[model samples]
Target: MSASAPTSFDKILIANRGEIACRVIRTARDLGYRTVAVFSDADRDALHVQLADEAVCIGEATASQSYLNMTAILDAARRTGANAVHPGYGFMSENAEFARACQAAGIVFIGPPVDAIHLMGSKRLSKIAMQDAGVPCIPGYEGEEQSDEQLLKEAKRIGLPLMIKASAGGGGRGMRVVTDASDIPEQLRSARSEAKNAFGSDELILERAVMRPRHVEIQVFGDTHGNVIHLGERDCSVQRRHQKVVEEAPSPAVDDALRARMGEAAVQAAKACDYVGAGTVEFLLDDKGDFFFLEMNTRLQVEHPVTELITGLDLVAWQIRVARGETLPLTQDQVQLNGHAMEVRLYAEDPAAGFMPQTGPVLAWQPASGEGVRIDHGLRAGYRVGSHYDPMLAKIIAWGDTREDARRRLIRAVEDTHLFGVTDNRRFLAAILRHPVFAEGAATTAFIGADFADDAGMHALAPQSHHWAIAAVLLSSQSPVTTRHWRNSGPHTQRLVLLQGDTRQTVSLAVSATAGPGVLDVTVGDQQHTVRLGASNQCIDNQSIEVDGVIRQPAWHRDGTQLWLDDAGQVFSISDVTHAPPATTAGAGTGQIRAPMDGAVLDVRCAEGDQVSKGQVMVLLEAMKIEHSLTSDVDGIVASVTVRNGDQVKGKQILLSITPDAPEA
Candidate 1:
């Protein structure tokens, strides 16, 4: 056992931004240590910056120039007289070189040893090490020879339905599941490309995809005194696009005996690397009670709140203590897992649009709060959510005496959370929590794709008549009371054409003054409804209204001809185009291929005059840390390409144009 003398640091610097930085600052302040925060230009007014004792602007908005800028971060700590730095997950959190640099600069690094991070950071090397340590691992190829031909040959030998994973980094980036042999080549290329962009490494490892296995991970902690212990397991099988959406502690599938086995294996994995501070060892637990090592995250995880709630422990505090050369507060047997806890990640994204990330001002922010509900976020009214960072905005956690109790509380918490002015997945999260499979704790990694893939709520729904009615009332109310009187006509009729996506709804509205002040008698189709409006609160962009005797207080915002409304968790966007002119086009058959979201152009596959088939990918864009492929909608010849590789673009910006082929020649 290696021992070290206890050290002290008066102030600590956080080398990241957003909720995680705020999380660390809270604990550090509670421990009576002064805290400093660093931010990019985009996050100058971020919640974390406001909460810190002092903040320093690191660099520009892009991550490469800011959060991931190791030299700038270290210099900030030096300039601030911070004796220690806490890298709160992501953006060099697990980087071995950063840890070494911190140590060399005489700044205490509050994480595992540099050697441990260097060894386990690579999936290929970690698997080999785990195998040598007698830890169970899935059978796959982790060879040094990373040729396309070699990978193809190995794929056939490994059989169908295998996974290709980037050797470095996590977060579901650079991962592909190949169920058919024909997809191996393209999937390989995509995975390698993403891996290179995300982790600076294109090397990969292959694993036989475990069928319907639960993604269970054991949370482990270590100290410089050679003590290591586990905090039990969290079931993270519920996922979308290989990214974890929901996480819970004390996995329903892990009984006492199974927990003992998995826990011991996780401890051994940590001890093998001489780990210290906090880490998690993930595994794929099959129905037969067999578990295989997946990977080890060498820093605090995004879902650490679940473990903290159940154990009644402050993990960040433990990290600080261990960094000061203090032994772990509790041993393996002394650590008690008390209650069940569940957590859901809230993202600023549109589930109806293939989970594309959204960015805009936060018109309103009301997070849920209760005895057992906790929210960790960095959001505020009027805060601008940019496209430069990850879309995840907050985490909601709930704890109860039992799993069902925790699940119920979490569901309610999700429903109660309110956010406006941007598209998000709150509705989708509530649906997942209410799912029968998830409620019964039978969810696997295939849960999202199998059950909710085609859920109607996951797609754009046509606007209902009531939606247009509400929009008409709001639009009419924008004018003076005198003009809203309809010129004292016996019956004033108005027409509205509201556009949502590519679908439009035309409604004929006839208003009568007899409905009284703040009310109107609006006719839609053959039905007449009484609509009453309350005073608008522009501060939060919300108002109370009664439609057909049903009272609802929905938050709404208006920008020119567009209106955004949020009722409960559902959002409706209505654009008044009643007097708008016909659409114009430069090519044939919806020929303009536009970017799906704000992103950097990774590749442009077609040039001018190139023949392309329907559904053939013409542009590759990277946004919110995910790659999106923009495809041609009709068979045509490309007329022009407006964007070049490495060009940053906004949402709906045209990338190219195609001229459709003549029919029936």
Candidate 2:
């Protein structure tokens, strides 16, 4: 490969999955490079696999056996004659060893140098490097001594409300906030466990937690020729569980002076590690406008689309060029920030349920499309959402002339988007976009937990009287007798149960068969409506339902006795319980502990006869690369343990049984 060949890749193997993979493939394809997608068993039929020129199955559903398996990925690259490898964001994106392996295997790693990744991979080491480079860093201890006692002492010295973070962790894993001194030991244990599981390291660093700070990150780019530039900053303060839910470019709080200072600091941080390609230098912007270095992400971010939109530049394309030993495309002075851009991560989790990861078929997937709206997703209708990956389903980004314009466009775009069948955070994201705090650009790290922590964001869609009538007509249309005998009966009443969130409503429908096959006169409550089904405008398997003269293309799907509808923006799940079997008491409030979702049991904290207290963690379930502690609901003695560590269990499957303690005499 010549040094002048800036974009000289015949084929590139994407060593990741989901939307990021698809994003990279789109850029690679546009650059006239053949893309090879690697997938696990669960993602064999995923959008990324289908979009690539060729695809190879790396391993099983587990990330360790697939995306993160360095040996398997190298082998796949070799087998497919892939000349370059693109680790898109997650998995092995920042793994220095993986980059070294790629170099040893003679494949181009489209990222930073191995030395850079190694130095910045550890938060402690990176902080030291930044301090030495004269960058503003958070006041903390990043010593090599990492014993439990030392950590506790450091936590004390750092004062209350300190943070314990894994030295080699990112993406909010291996991180914990300790507001009380007594909780340090337990938080340390949990943080270390997660760190070891996530980054293969248990070493920790202590820092004083900056309260109510805004998370602002600068997008930096570098090349092998010693050129680096910052593309302004993005405010990612709208977060949940320490992970960013919404991100926007040209932070509302950052003025021109602040932007220059933060951008210069970010560029210095990048230069300290001799960084290359796309990287983000995150900072905690305090109330007084003082910013401290948080960490550096040495890979493309999931929210890269916002930067791309605002700058009108393709970051993936830049990564490819930089990997080929190219010079920087533009200098710092040449980099210009354009209009305001914002993005929201649409996740496959129920925000009302503590953001628990959900797995089910995507019955209907209709992404928003318009002039300013950009939807980056890797989902399709009928796509099965497994528990072995992140819960993020898609990202909706909108760009406009101003921040308010962008915010309004994004809210409308989110409302226009729809994803059915699985419990998702669409409504939750819409609520966030419309929240007063968010709209005012005053969202801090505690925005979600403080403002919309409960189901306030999940307000139920008020069911109109005509909606019930439409439901009745649709229900009756499903019956064979109603279609055959159009003008027979005067009116027939039917009862159906529909569940939305925690509220269950029994809807009574009186339909007249004389109205004809395509139309029905239905009475729901005291109101009556003439509902009609329009001519099937089949876009894939979805159809349009014309009710009372209004034509609505409702994205809908049916599976057995369940029907899901996405009318306008509200997603309604209707189930027919007319002839359903009586509810069984087999698992009714039994002290049996069930798995929260499909996951592999990482460890069982209690034995069969072990006595446990209420809220004591009995088992640790690992799913989507995150560990979930299954706690006991009541104080009891473990009666039976049915699952062992490493056992793969389905959602709601019994893992253990706890017999409640007998009343003390």
Candidate 3:
């Protein structure tokens, strides 16, 4: 690879989808380069495709047939006469073979060198390289012996509470935590299976788990001219399922001294592999200020916005410049860090339901915008979020003079933003930001487990009386026959049942003449409240609800009998089940098994006529890049199997059925 000659290209192809692809297009267009977007059949009409100069359909919705199809991506670029390809993270970003193929095809790969990607893509090899470079690292086994017996023997030496990580991938996929010695074998098998399914490699790497440590990483930029520098650090400790949900720049836990040391180590790691372009060196920072090298991500990260906000630099632009054989724009001494910045990922998932990935049409989307706020997304009102990709929908970033200021601004941003129809973690993100531990900058990797047990009060929370009243008034107002519902000379009342989650409440509403028009008295249970709306018949859009004496401006979306309300930051989904029949509760030990979401069957652990116990793992479903173990709710005999291995199943589709065992006499 020669860095002496500058290479220039007129067209650049983005080899990814969603926000990241849209993100790259913005930068490439700004730099006067024509952008080509490659899309799968599912994303033919996606936001990124519409934003690009041209788009090519690569394959079907499945990742293996589209986004991961290297030949198809390269073919799209070749057909469009694109001389450059920017793999916008994920997909083929860390794929060394893809990079090498691009180089062979005479197309500029706007990322790290192929060798750097190959060495850093593997956790096992990267750890060895970091150790050889004299960087601080945790004691672990990254041996070539990948046998179960060998891993089990190594686990005994490493003791309990070790981390089982995939050597070929990250993003919490193919990773497991083994806290008991006896569970090592199962964890090893699970990790290897996931590793192969996700990265096509089942190689395992064991690391001594660093309990309750801050996940701090340095953003390092390298150019073809042999120059590399760090742009400070980011604290990414607030995570769930080993995936980061919130990230902030200039870690509150790191002082100037600690930053300098970590920054130097990150630069060393980049240079060790002769890296060029954008990369991240992750570290595990302990309470004593000591840090250990984790691994290096060979491409742009999902949380790069916060770092860009603090540094006032476009890392994507830097990658393009470096691909053109440019030198570092700023030296180590010239680099500067500005005010604090924080970002939170908005995912289409139900935090109360084990953070399971959700899929549906985005009925509405109104991202918050104001001073110091930035929303990066590719969402529109009617775009359908599919199960073929990741669940992350968008990212909200805020910058402020201080960490607290950023936190407060972020909380407000989350409150103002609204996305209905599909469930999200917006409220959950707000909870983490407002938590005392996070407010004090004391949160670690265990923050979610420690502070958000049972989803941090999210699951247990039922709609308040005010919520019910507001919902009832809104429902009554939206009725087509508004004359009888909104205005009544005599005493006229209506009763309705609103269901939220498993909690059902019957609310009675009556027109109240005391507060002029659009006023109604609502009663839920024994509590009565005065609910005033802005208009008599207006139910959708922005509405004002003055419950009792308190007033709140809430955004609402009504689809048929289902209503979604975003009051401040707390979101509620209320269904008008008044005319609907009472729902029958499936027996506690029912043998009906259904798929939770649209996914592919990875394994069927039971067969027809097989006896199964309640809580036994019956099937493994893979959806949105995560494996879900479906268990039997009752002990029974398998009567039928509707899904086979590698079969695609829709949400709520029955995977199998079992005949319940005879009850005790």
Candidate 4:
């Protein structure tokens, strides 16, 4: 690779979607290149589509036909007369064959060489590269070990809390944490199964696990001509299930000396593979400050915004620049970082419900703003959140003069946010941002685990806040203060929403005819939560609405007197008691709840009702969405059976019920 600008390629094809696609297009446009966007059928009206100079529908709902389809992406590039192709992140971003295809078609692939991609793509192969580069690595069996006996010998060397990682894996998939030696065999089997299903490879790698370590990575850039520079480090220790939830720059943990060591290690690793363009060298830093090489990502990362904010560099633009034969404009000595930056991933999952992926239309949405807040979003309000790709909805990034300022600002940003529709985990993110431990920056990869012991901890705030918010909103159900219930000045009635866990109050409360619309004021105790409504809140062209300060589209439904609010894949039912039945016979129906969705049978309690206590776990269901336990609504006897073992039931379907007794039954 050389450091001279080649000066070619008039048009480039972006073979991805979501924020990454838009991210690449922004850089391409700045580089005087016409951009073409390849979108799936589900992304026809996506934000990226609107941003691209040209857009072509690549395939159906699933990624198999669109982003992952090599032929389709290459064909799009060829059809669009694009001389270069950018894979962005995920999908085929690191696929060696995909890169080679672009080269074969005479189009520049905006990544490392095919050989480097292939070598680093395999964890086993990368181990060899890292070893050759003198990078510190945990003792593991990257070599062939067929029998349990052979693997066990290596496991003892790696010690307990070992990891069973897939040779062909990234983004935390195809990996398992094995804590006990006795669990190794079964885990090996399951890990291999997951790897096969996910990456079409059962080739597994084993490595020692670091105890309570910070997940830090150095962002490095390289060129064809023996040149490379490190862009400091990013702290991604705050995570859940080995995936980063929040990320920041200039780690509160890593000082200058440690950052230098990591930066040098990262530079050497990149040079070992002769890497080019934007990439990351991940590391697992132990409690004792000792570090071990985790893996090298040969493409842009989702949390690149943090680095960009601190270094005042557009990583995507630099990637394009270096790919186009430009030297890294800044030298190693010139590379300096200022200020602190934090980024929170907004996912479409319910944190309380085990972070399961949710899908629906964005009924209302508005990204947080003011000061240093920026939102890298994929969908607009009203756009449907599909189940085809990742569940991440957006990246809400904020920069501040210091880490504490960033933390405080991010919390304020979230609190002011108001959203509904397509369920987003904004509130959960807000909770994490404001968490005492997180605020102190004493985080590790297992941070979420260290704190969120239960559903209440997951939210990190008083349950009454929601109650107050709902109460304020519900107040809208009553007429305005100026008009009495008997008077006709104010609107008589309004809409009261009931979800599985939360409630909302909406109304057409008017002060003047020209007032247009107002807000839903939710009151709890001494606090009042106001959510904007009507014209000022709507997106105009889309179904999404913006109330307070968050971006969300809540899932909603109505049945009889109960209105449900589905936010981020969680069904929170709030009672709409305006019309509930007055009274029932002694033993009729206590309305025993059942499984609301399909999931694995984890635990089961209670047989028939047998006069069980309220909120008692009746059964447990573990789905890809998350884990939830069904509880009894009231005391009664098991009345009917509609489902059994492994049966998948739709929401609201009666699985088993406890028919109330007539006092003597």
Candidate 5:
């Protein structure tokens, strides 16, 4: 029996987690709908749970045990008497089985139908449909054979540099680009395995990797009444590892004619799938604006805010409306393009450290705000950056009448953001905006990899600017400023060494007092730098500067390299020579106990001349937000410890050494 669609549901349950959950709940409540939320064991006290009108704990911390458990989510919805279920993008948003289950149980799934999802979610079937719909698609094999040898043959026919992709997944996972024949079979096998693990589908597809094509997508919406329309386009060419880090609407390159053609194709694709609710049709466009269909996201995208800003439409509210069996409220002719929009994904990763994930408590949290700036963040003032889920912490979006305005706004907003406790990529993002290539809008998927090979662009300034900036922030934020009392009233130059992990560099700066009491104008090598003092006057004053505009907390102290930053639930240290004392090889010890990796000491195990055995857990060193037990190298007594638990240790910091003493009996 087809249940009668209510004009509006009294309540809805969010079958997802994180920022999107909080985002949807806010809109739902504003629409006068009570919201129910679910959480895993680790997220019991998560911000989204607190924001919801009702909350329930589902399972453990792992994604499979909690968020992806469709039955558990549907069961929670049923138990809570929620008439509608909204899957926020990731976990089960595109799962056909989950939609079928919801329909079987009489709950409204706020997305496209199960048939639509099933038909389009399969990349193989979608390719056929798109080809049938007159959409310009790439020349590749969408054949039947699934054998490794068969796929290899097809790859040879399609030529080199082809993409081996999972037939049922997106998001750059379950995909591989093989450049040589020797790498094909292994990559094919890996792709299939990852596809199976991620989407429960080992079947794969092959496509010719387009050269320098821009990734532009159209946000499309459709209802059961067969009406579908597109809302402009998003430029997602600036990516890393095939995943988008920055997105913008009103693409700088796409002209009116190109948009209209792409929009028409998107609508036809949605109609072919009988798509319902909000979705985005992804496409790859060549330099001349000729395009090919990539995939149709059956759920709302994370960068939907850009579309909202450009089109002045509330996609979430529209999603709720369409789920209630409403027809398209407007036509294609009704859409209007007003402004430029951009969104930057802030992740808990150290870009300088090969983008490794970091976890820790949030010491300071100040998101950007003002005209045309918005922050969709799940974290609060004291939230811990976790490692179990995607590393994205918040999305900072900006909107303006012009693209230049949006860029300037983003740069200013990112600079104003003050984050602590956990390491964030704020400086890196800011640097991208100020970069010459990005400023000219000349970036592609290879832009980051090419421009940042040496990271010279992101870390553009010299050591003098950085040191003075840190000192300026510290002096301004901490101690009271007094008059510059130098007897000669000349430049007071000081030489200092800066250390990051195991690397060290020496630099000298001539510090001259500026016009302001807490201001300093410093000169390094041949360039002059200016710095404003911070609030604190103690250790680094009390303020920190944004590193390269990707807001990362600075870790420098007056003593040894004993800097601390937490990631997820663990603490990580930033080691340097300033924190590492001289090796204590004075006592009975062997060769030496060298620091394994660049990290900070969480604790020291044995003291000077303590009897120790082989394979013993001697010390605890933390790096990249995870702990490693620094065990003894040989069975003997530890001679002496040169570093403390809170001290930062470099790659070769000799903590202690077991001397070659009397033979162990």
Candidate 6:
């Protein structure tokens, strides 16, 4: 175990999935190490599986049955003859028991020491440890008392506008912001339930929510040789639901003095637990320029690419080198920060609809490519996105000499990136990048909620006459025909009802003889336009259409009468209600609760014949690792419950039915 000894492992098993696994594989391969990938049934054909030197099927689609199955992961490593295990980010990455298991199995875990993981894994314990280490921490309650009365008492003592967080939770799960004292009880219940389901722990922690604080985290690394260094800091202030959306290096608010202080505090926090390998110390900086320790993430962060871009270093590579007993390559003074770097997390979720996750096949994916642009993803055409995991599809990073330059480049890159079949947040991220508040570098944690609360990004773009005309022409014909049917016969007109959010547009395509063989006279409301159809390159659900004289290659995915078009960065769902069936009125007349998205029913709150009030929780559905409660729209007696707990449901599927209240019997 000498510090200078050569790394022992020839093959490293990545016990995780998605972009992070692929990320680690690339770096390990560059270091001349063969990589093994463990995959769940859902990820059988994932890009990471194909890129690895060896692949193993661990278990089922659910994370607990697969990626989180420590025993199965270790067995896969043993079967593949892998001498080391790299827990890439999410699954079991910071689990202390997983690290200990790796050590007992005689495999190198490419992360921090087991003690460090244990200490930072619990929010309550980590806050106490940070205070003891002389790190400034937020005022809150971190006691052993678990009673509801005790928690209520502490919340009152801490004052209102506090945060209730799960001791063992990350990624914004098991966390709630309580503004009013009356809402604390309900928030506490929800947080505990989500925590137990997500992390197998129900421990709670309370902290005073800092108003409009900037989230800044210092990336620190350590080695077995007792060397540690901080690689500057990243500002992750642009967040939604307490999770980071956009991250950038060299925070706009931090100067040399503040950075030095934060970096020193981060390094001290790491040393307090004898931490080793890559870890991040998060802090919330207030308006007064004071920073408080939040927590520590003992794994490669999702926003690590921004740090790498600014520092000219591969953090994953450093992790492996450190795990192999290598000392720090550069001292704190030697490490230099370069140009500004920014990253946006591209997710398959609809920002217009409460950021609900969407799942489907990736019909077409064209990532942006140019100078200063980098796409880190595990996505490919034909890849199926399931609701069994996170909704993030990729991370796009851009670097420039200035923050504005980096921001502009990232915006342009996001505009060029196109995806189909699944609804995504590409336009949403672009909007955030171009917002004046963000452009001025003054975005805090309240950026999303305050500035773009209504999701103006998706609705800001009004469909032009040309856009409607293009849609009409594409929908009028399925193939190229030699004879002009409308010319030979009478003028035939087709009507299309296109829906975008709540707005609906009726487009009529009138095929006439005077117009060419493939020409159509389109009319949308009072706007009239002439559109000519040209050669189309159709690939499954995707198509490149030439409308009028302009050629736009829009990624298209059609399901029955509904078509999704990804043109540039804008996404539109066009429904051709030409041959649609009559709607059923029975469920509409009565009260019916339908599933919001494709997910598994986690709990059923009511049974048949049960009386329920309006806005009462009827069914709880779990999708994309988040729980959504389906509430009753009208107070009525339950007539039938179609779905039970553990039942998988599709979007708009009826989960239960309620009969209108009866008059006096």
Candidate closest to the true structure, highest TM-score: 3
Ranking by lDDT: 3, 1, 6, 2, 5, 4
The reply for model 5, stretches above 4 Å from the true place, is 1-8, 455-665
Worst lDDT 10-window in candidate 4: 534-543
lDDT of each: 0.87, 0.83, 0.89, 0.72, 0.74, 0.86
- Compared with the true structure, what per-residue lDDT tens digits does model 5 show for residues 9-96? 6789999888999999999999999999999986887889999999988787667789888878888887889988999898889889
How many residue-pair clashes does candidate 3 contain? 0
Tens digit of per-residue lDDT, candidate 2, span 334-430: 8888999999998887665667888888777888889899999999887899889988888999999999999999988887787777887777887
Per-residue CA lDDT of model 1 for 1-665, tens digit only, reads 67889988979999988889999999999999999999999898899999999999999888999999999999999999999999998888999999999999999999999999999899999999999999999999998999999999998899878999999878788998889988999999999998998788999999899988999999999999999999999999998877899999999999999999999999999999999999999999999999999999999999999999999999999999999999999989998998899999999998887788998888778888897999999888778888889999999999999999999999888877888778888888888988888899899998998976776657765656676678777765663432245544566666777787777766655554666545677666666778877776344454778899898776677766777776666677778887789877643357799877788898999899999999999999988877789889889899989999999998888999998888875
Report the lDDT of model 1 for residue 524: 61
Off by over 4 Å in 4: 1-7, 454-665
Tens digit per residue, CA lDDT, model 4, 1-665:
54554857788899888888888898789878899999888789898989989888888756777889888888888788999888889898999999998888899998888888998888898988899889988778898665667766777788788988989986566788888888988888888787887789988888887778899999999987778889999999988877888999989989999999999999999999888888899999988888888889899999999999998999888888777887788989999899999998888776655666666676556566899887787767668775557788778888999998888887766644444554467777776776777888887887778774443536522223543243224333332432123223554334343323433333232222232344443333455445543321213122233344554554343333333343332334355543345434432246556454434455556565366655667776654434567777766676665556555554445666776545654
- TM-score for every candidate vs. truth? 0.91, 0.91, 0.95, 0.78, 0.76, 0.91
Residue 235's lDDT in candidate 4? 95
Question: Mind giving the per-residue lDDT tens digits that candidate 3 earns over 1-665?
Answer: 34568888999999999999999999999999999999999898789999999999999999989999999999999999999999988899999999999999999999998899999988999999999999999888999998998998898898878999999988788899889888898999999998998778999999899899999999999888788899999999998878998999989999899999999999999999998999999999988888999999999999999999998999999999889888888999998898999999999998788789998888888999898999999988879888888999999999999998899999999889999988898988998898888899999999988876654535635677788888887776767645244555777788898899878899988888676666778889999899777763323366667899888888888888888888887789899999998687664467888988888899999999999999999999988878899999888899999989999889888889989899999
Segments of candidate 2 deviating more than 4 angstroms: 1-7, 458-467, 483-485, 494-505, 511-530, 536-553, 605-618, 631-641, 656-665
Task: Find the 10 residues in a row with the least total lDDT in model 3.
Answer: 535-544
| Over 4 Å off, model 6 | 1-6, 146-157, 178-197, 458-462, 479-506, 510-520, 540-562, 586-590, 661-665
**Winner on lDDT (3 vs 5):** 3
Better of 4 and 6 by lDDT: 6
